[model samples]
Target: MVAVSQNKSIDGRLVAIGCNYEPWIALLEQSGWKTHCCYDLRTADSILEEYSPCICVVDLSNNDFSLNSISLRANKTKQVKWIAIIKKEQLKTDAIRQFINNFCVDYFTVPIPGSHLLDTIGHQLGMLDIEASSWVEITSQHDMGLFGESKSIKQLRDMVRRVAMTEVNVFLTGENGTGKELIAKSIHNLSKRKNAPFVLVNCSSLARDDEKLSLLDGTYRNEEGAPFDGTLMLDNVEELSKELQDNLLAYLQAPSCESLDEEMASDVRIVATSSADLDAAVANGDFSKELYYRLNVFHIKVPTLRERGSDIFLLAETFLTKFAREYSTMASTFSEDSKQLLLRYSWPGNVRELINQVKRAALLAEGNEVKAEHFDLPSKANLKQSLRNIKDEAEKDVLVAVLETHRGQVASAAKDLGVSRATMYRLLNKHNIVPDVRHYNNGYARE
Candidate 1:
């Protein structure tokens, strides 16, 4: 009976802000979310007061005003699930970004296939039900900084936590600069292996012949009494020569000679990264099949920046703060135009691109606010054939208009754009617009 009741409770109510009977709602309703729509604060509050919905969906289309009010209510109520629905281009805006960081529980962006969205939402609902089951009263904590609230990232994080508690091998797969190495370090930090040496080797940097031999033959402990129990991260393992692949596998298979006297045995937990498709490589007879299978024991795939939904700005701000501190730049906020641009960009280089841009902008910025002119993005002509072209232009136009409207509070600009705070920074980057540069707490721009 208890199991029956528990299983039935997965169905949840959804309070939608800024929507008007979209086909998706009908689909959601079919899947068990009792969907209700609201276009304004009054209607939203009334629905909240009446149905006590467990989830709230904020529609970004025609809904800038609702963002401010909904965030306030979500903070006050503290129990409702708030999800943001937005286009991929909107991620470049400051307002949308800011709103998500402060209030959103999750997000679904454009190009999100219907099946994927449904699966993600279903997973979120299931997780919420589990959280609600505990007897110990605890507040749920949500971190919106990583640009993803999807099931994939959630599942990956859960796996990271579980794997971190153990001593084993972890292999991460992602596009170049998708932060595979960062995730590896995160796992290392969270593990009992934190105190041990964390060695990183870039397999791609080594020549094919050099990579084939035991590169570490004399680097560390050729003699005895050397330390072990460290973390070894083989970066870009897809680049390993066939000979090297076989050599490493042979070492891994031999626990006797490889062991550093059993007691001081190689307690090294292996973490490997690959931007290329190792499976395909092995299937194509380019890489050793056995090596690929060995590394597949545990895996994590970091999503690209464009797929992270509204967390784009969160990551931008993180880079902004780090760059500002390092460069002593006065850029305090992103212009509305700048915010939109950030969301519009399809970051091919992922977080690394954002970081590089932020660093460059900080050093070259003329005022407290970084302006669109500060960034040296590709020319509109060059971007014409790019996938993000349309998104980029729309972001520029909207941000230019928003900045004209708000003068620049970052907060105000974001509010006008109907996005979260973190999103605003992305807009700035997208359009290459900078914000007013002001000395921290000094309240004044230099010139």
Candidate 2:
């Protein structure tokens, strides 16, 4: 099972502070919430430890608790999503402001709108089930940073092993920060070409034709003007200009004897990565279809950090240990609050972002443990945006799968998904996927 970060929705279980025998408690119970009431923060913390409830409600409207009492317990928000209920006048207090901003995920003034409170609670509970329920399998640890215990990562690792032994060109695709480069490198290291020089061609930087040729003629060039017998990875291959695309496709299709020069015969294996949708690019006439097909002889979709579930913590721990030793920081372990924040934040930057944030957090951490504040925890607005991204990515996956299952037929996929053709097309375009119904754009088919 996933750690606390990847658990189920709230089990209708809650700990309500300063709300003993109140009308709110009755409303919650009537709504099927198993309300556990506590008078003080200390008592509530004990209950939270025991129950591990998804939510904790602190109703300060009717209670006479001092602001200090609330501030002292703010750290208790480790894994629980805190909802504060206060009188309208308490909004002006600095302590009250800090309590809400620093601890609570949300707050409401007195005469709370019952519906909105319930909605917020429901949202938090729903977040607990994010991309977690489907994966629970664990795989053996790797010495590298691809350390994950989730089923998705295990499958990805297995695929890497399978593909590494082949001689066909590899096409790695995923979000920009999902470590496509690392995957490519891993493939190269495992392949027979491990002894040869592996070269990276940043396709985006090849703005000028001469500059592109310079990499071919410069980086891995032997004395004979031929590239070394190794792998040549085209990073961000989607950005290739039509001219470069033509040249690359010609080079890949040509036999080894048709070298750049009569004296040289190139022996490099091609591996390319694209963060953009080559199908949509091909459909929109933005990329060369021939190059896409040639590079895609073996395709691997690297799983995003969010899709890897509990691997978030695994990566974080790995980065922490590595950087702690390097940076000589005391931040060895993540505090409970930090762990929750790490899981909740959508990690748009993926593993790359996680590494930077962890390294920075470790250096900034004052004590032995890394706290949420050490990572520059997200504001309420940022958290909402991140959560929305998580939802959007999940939706995009569904759209891709449905469309693929129907052999890229938009009408059929739309009907299967119970969405209108227009809606399906809209989603397809939104996710940068184009239905496979199309004509050529000056690129040859492999058949």
Q: Best candidate, lDDT-wise?
A: 2
Kindly provide the TM-score of model 1 when superposed on the true structure, using C-alpha atoms. Answer: 0.52
For 1-447, candidate 1 gives per-residue lDDT tens digits of: 000001135655556666666666656656655543444677667666554335666677555665666667766542356777788888898988888876676788853356665676667666556545421121111222223455556555556655665676888888887778777876776667777767888887767567323423323452455645568889989888777887778767766556445554455677999988788898789988877777777887778777775667766676777778878888767777677677676788887787787778777777777766676666444555675666778877777666655655677878887899889988687567766634223222222
Instruction: Give the Å shift of residue 150 in candidate 2.
Output: 1.5
The Cα RMSD of model 2 versus the native structure comes to 24.7
For all candidates in order, the CA lDDT equals: 0.66, 0.72
Off by over 4 Å in 1: 1-153, 207-219, 222-224, 256-260, 379-384, 388-447
Which ten-residue region of model 2 has the weakest summed lDDT? 131-140
| Candidate achieving the largest TM-score | 2
How accurate locally is residue 215 in candidate 2, as Cα lDDT from 0 to 100? 41
Per-model TM against the reference: 0.52, 0.55
Provide the lowest-lDDT 10-residue window in model 1: 135-144
